[model samples]
Target: MTEERVVGLLERLLQAKVGHDVARLIEKRLGRKLEPFDIWYDGFKARSGLDERRLDAMVRERFPTTDAFQQNLPAILEALGFDRDTARFLAAHIEVDPARGAGHAWGPVMRGGKAHLRTRVPKGGMDYKGFNIAMHELGHTVEQVFSLYRVENTLMAGVPNNAFTEGFAFVFQARDLDVLGAGGADPERDACRTLDAFWSAREIAGVALVDIGVWHWMLEHPDASPAQLREAAVKIATDVWNRHFAPFMGVKDSPILAIYSHMISYPLYLSHYPLGFIVAYQVEDYFRSHPLAENMERMCRQGRLTPDLWMKRAVGSPVSADPMIRGAERAVKSLLKH
Candidate 1:
């Protein structure tokens, strides 16, 4: 079958898996009654502005599916401005595994000298969610690579916590299209980014609220059953959904909370997404004015830095919601202004 046909098939599969509500909402927005095939086809093609042939080529070129990630690691590292020795050190330690459900970075102070990565995402997972996961893993890998090879000592060679690293990962993940030289900046691409940014920011912000509430609930009801946890999660999720998303959806349900996979594995990771969004945009803005290489290396080298210190050093200010909120607002305004 042709690549477009494959992409279409994947999209249909995705829509089928996600549920009718999401599919219908997307269909309406796209100005048609949506079919499963349209989910992947329309959504992917819309954001990327690339047909199957080009998208496949781009993906293959960038996401190395084998041991050869070693070869690419140096270029990526060097692009972010690592020194030659540091780049080589990172290249030797970049491990690509096929064992993970998605992707991950296990590195920086483990007994092993190298960082291991797993890239076993489900098929058709190449959509925005999958890509975001991929880029976030890339962010983690880069941090691992930098801290292990470039930092002064093992003690300091890593991020202080998962959220801070996730913040960096979020920053890199947002740049996936830009890094790949895909469609961006023009009217079509800007519209795509705006829609995605809106969708992502809204979805994640709600999840963050749910996560916070769930944690507090968990703390209070330490012996809460899985069912109780799930029930409480649904209530919290519905609350956030009603406040933020009900206007857009015209419906409310707690099943939405059940859909967040991270809620099961990483209880607190949801909060990091929104925080990462803020940090990513802040870093993105900084990279706009400063050279990507010099600034990024300096930022990475300051391993395990406090969030406040890291933000000040990298973005010339403390971490705040202003960057993401303002950037998103401006993106919307620009689209409306046009």
Candidate 2:
């Protein structure tokens, strides 16, 4: 069910004429023709054009130490609509630490243990990227707490899969600017956000296809040498790009899809990202006018049901790209008309 829904969405996105139109719009915004690597375009985001140095300075001033970020968790949760007690309970259950790597959330294995959120903090303090990552990890920690501490059964103590957690992470990541008091609600901005989500979803979907194809190639030629595997990986990536990305990117046989480190380091893990985006969009849409903290607490407490079942319980529908696609289409029409 998950595979069919994701693949069906990707196919529709690839075939949709809006992909080309949105590509042109993005190119105009960029003041250049599109390139194959533009699949990862960031211009539609509000922060894309901001000076990183300025953002870093702001973040450093706000969170000069890991403890500073940690101390603010309750307030952050409160700002998202959690009551004082609920916010404090969640904050008490999560521990923040400086990470050696990018950042990750480590949930507790036993009751009465704290969930850990590990994120990098440089000597200068947490920069914008680190803070953004911290917020993402915070989302995971919150989900971890809700799913574990609030769940009725210890056997069902997490979301169904990584994609669901990733979706929750995105829910928090999307609100970084809001948390900083840097932006507010606007119809145009909301529309752009939808388009941004669509483009990102479209990009990773192709990369995932390549990831799947390359693994299949490996299975078919198990005796192939390292050189042969590398050649096959590149060929599969190029083929996937040609089929799905070339029409919009105006480049053929681009190996850009194979550039993700996960393809080499984390076998068969690429699909979760695009699927995460789909889940995020659907979950976000469902809670658009509702209280996020309350609804999120309820949803996470559903615990380890199957993905389709969890989604059906959380939202009114199963995981599908239709909501996001329809949103992007409306956004495109609205943006282009003006």
User: Candidate 2 residues 174-264, lDDT tens each?
Assistant: 8887787776877777778888888998999888888878888888998999899888888988988888888888889898888876876
TM-scores for candidates 1 onward, in order: 0.73, 0.94
Model 2, residue 321: C-alpha shift (Å) = 0.8
Clashing pairs in 1: 11-40, 12-36, 12-37
lDDT of each: 0.59, 0.86
Candidate 2 regions with alpha-carbon error over 4 angstroms: 1-5, 49-54
* Clash count (model 1, backbone only): 3
